[model samples]
Target chain A: MLEKANDWSDTFYDKWKPIAMGFVNGAEKCLQCGKCTGQCPAAAVNPSYNPRKIIYDLVNGNIKRVLSSVELWQCFFCSGCFATCPVDINFPFFVFMLRLGAMSQGFGWEDVKQLEKYAEKDYLQDGITVSPEERNPYVIEERGDIADIRQKAGMPRQREVSDEAIAEINMISDLSGMTNFMKKIGGVELYDCSKCTPKIEEKCKSKELPKKVGNVKTHYRFYNYGVPIGGADNA
Target chain B: MHKLDKLSGIREEIVADIPIPEEIFYFQSCVASNKYPGIESCTLDVLNKLGVKPFVSEDQTCCGGFVTFANVAAPTASMPAVARNISLAEEEGLDICAVCNGCWTFLNEFGHFMNGNDEVKESVNMMLNMMGREYKGESNIFHIGAMLYKLKDRIAENVERPLEGLKFATHYGCHYLGGGKYGAIDDAQHPSFIQELVEIMGGENVDYTASGECCGTGFTQVINDKEKSLDHSQMKLESVRDEADPDFVIVLCPYCLSQLDRMQQQLDYRRDVKLDIPIIHITQLAGLALGLPKERLAFDAHIGGQDRFKKALNKIGIDY
Candidate 1:
């Protein structure tokens, strides 16, 4: 571990100050007790993904290595580690900040481009992220069916966001630099069903063919680690 | 010692007995309103039956959590949006009652962030000024599950349909219990609030080994990393199936409901794993106990375990 500190610099702490601010007391507060790794759902599934190691690297000023690693994108942000941490490190917040750092450095665009599409098409247009009408035909039809059921149930067809509220939402998105970030990441290109073969088009329409982006390997099936009862002593 | 002392104080405040409010601003969720509208309706129905008046506002939009958690943007980018939504509740002079865990946790965490960082709060307030709104961090955000847990006795008194002879397994989801920074109403590691509510509703609680694990919706993970996402859900489902074959699983978040319900079918098709347990939001179960009709519960919207759920309801002499 000491040998891994060769890349450390005098200005390292100051350079990575923003990311360290995400943690409760800075990443150096991590006790390195391995308790967080024990409770991490991502670590249980993927041996290569360790929260303790991430904290260690951050504390040792390995910003480039930590930001460039594929493991940075694998955290579920479940906050299980935070819940069990003795010092309350808030690992999810730290990981979220690290992901932002990774994004600014152009490391994890493929992992988040689909999200970019959702932000552009759904959130920007409707002020909501999961608007089924903005999705494929199958989802649109399913949403319609849900509306009919809601009507039969004597509930409103849908929750209404006033035009004023939606306009304000769009303004907030723009003013907060969210719209700029989406554009900076390269706006999602619309998928043309006409260009695909009939079979592929059908699958594409159903959103089953064009797979999601990411390269995180999960072994949840083979690894049957019984419930992770967390504590440093348990670790 | 300083951090631990502060946390312990927060924990004490969390565990203190507080009065349940009679009225609250109902914060809407994107997934619940679009995909599972029943969860929204059931939330209102149960709240009404409990003599709680929930003010549903048309001026509110999505919680903007999916954007941040999905990695589409940073937390700071969504701070203004979160402040704007919470400001609506503040304007009403009422606490917030959120039906979805994502909305509940996001609102609270973001509110906590703004309260601590004056500069960030000032900037967020400046952004909100464009809409003639400001976030004072005045309203307390509470999940409907926590509200229901606090009103367990009231719930028991209004049980028109007792869930007798039914066994329920619960998935608390990650955001509500684990993502809380200030602390939660119950112990995060060993929570029994749901089980206590199950008992009050005349249902038996089934214990599973992986009760505390995440459902693995992971926002974007389900879309981008389907295999890994489904694998996490598969682990929880298999544990519940092998340990205790509950009649249905109860969840607090709409995202967890979608992931656990829809992914069971995916697992059946992909891995041939036969875990056909029905998944229902806590409000849906509360709706049934309050004697709401089957159509109002909207079990039809679910992708898996509807038939099994119908059979279980039939055994209790209730028509599906």
Candidate 2:
């Protein structure tokens, strides 16, 4: 159950001021119409991941709980909610900001660590994120074959980023604080999952989760809210 | 004001004017260039055939959008990279034409952020100044999908082989349509631009219920929560199969193309259903209609549905 707001606090709102001051008034215009929840693809598959409730919590100043919860990370950034939003709230961007806030508070670091292995490593080296050199053997072979096919098709074997461009990208990554933030988060301890639901705990203990999810291999634990709220089930 | 009145006012603000450029910077995508080079090549071929000059620069780097979307970095962290990339296009004095939805949406969204936030713009420009570049925000970023839609008439005129007797279902992808407030070319809720393109190419447009649904290549979700991601794709593909059994599923973005095309094999194994639908990029579709060789379209890069695509072509009596 959502915690009732006996006394509203602007502390959380003040920390993320740009959200409120900027686009769509930071969910202030939300009419609780539940249109965003209805249109969300993530919510459809995961009953625990509720966009409407997240926005409601944000509006009611239930920041601490929302930021730390696993529901914050469930959004795939599809922007379906934004398209269906009556007032055009841009829920994906809102979720993006919320994820950032969660990260700052030492939550969702495991997910970022996974990204470091899959994307950031290659992105830092080459100007591209998912380069074939660092991928699995299948991908490397497939990419090499594609390169051959591209050559036959009259295109370059692969996109060539100039040495100067690579240097510029490296510099931008450094100067923009990405390098430092990554290095800082690298040493930070993972978010404690013990506080999460028993379902996630069981999945973690039973070790039934696949070593590889989709394309990349990860030990990241997926979470679920304890129960369905108001019996809402889109699946 | 009434709720409907407010909604229309907001819609009026975001419905962007479509501009047809004679030349575009042609921002290349990492995924398309690596996994599916055909999308890049086909986009170039189709655009050139439609009289749009595509200039690709070696100086431009990745948009670094994956880092942000993957939850590795904040949008501000990639702002400098985004600025630098757009500055490269601005330096050429041409608008950007991104073949992939990720490239255009990241450029446009981050570009919009930098445009609105003076502090962010100043900081990002400061970093770019170190590289002897500055983002002027003059160039407008356009997806090749929108550009193709704008040149539908020209495409219709140059159709050497109309895609007759072929049925196509369209997937506009999430970023191209759902990346909000950018004044998308079509209605985000009920987008029919790709369907319209298919019809113009002499193909039948098959309607499906999950046309507006995501393809489930959620940058990190596909990696972290694979079940949910695949479940979403399964739902969409099943809908396309059951409701509209088209010869091909047309998509605008390479990410969507890769997800929907590659996942059919996974879905076939996970479920008892066999959805052997060939997923084709709109540019590739246009390239086919414009009489480009099948090799140039590079259908070989795709994983599943090759046999079905060939059978469909054989049925249509169209030989490359």
Model 2 residue A35 CA deviation (Å) reads: 0.6
Give the docking tier of candidate 2: acceptable
Name the lDDT of candidate 1. Answer: 0.75
Q: lDDT by residue for model 2 over A46-148, one digit each (tens)?
A: 7778888888888778876677677787898888888788887888777777776665555566666667754456777778876744244444444357678
- With candidate 1 superimposed using the best TM-score fit, by how many Å does residue B6's alpha carbon deviate from the native? 27
The list of candidate 1 runs beyond 4 A from truth reads A1-14, A18-24, A133-144, A187-235, B1-17
C-alpha DockQ for predicted model 1: 0.38
Q: Which segments of candidate 2 are over 4 A away from where they belong?
A: A1-10, A19-24, A133-144, A187-225, A228-234, B1-17, B316-320
lDDT of 2 by residue, B1-320 (tens): 11322332223223346567788898988878877878888888998999988998998777887887776666666778898999998988999888887887888888887898888789888888887999988988887877887888899899987888888888988887778445577677766667667778888877888888889877678777777788888888889889988889988888888889878877776766688888988888998889888778888777767678788877755552
> Model 1 misses residue A222 by how many Å?
24
**Least lDDT summed over 10 consecutive residues: which range in candidate 2 chain B?**
B1-10
Best by TM-score: 2
The collision pairs in model 1 are none
- lDDT, residue B240, candidate 1: 83
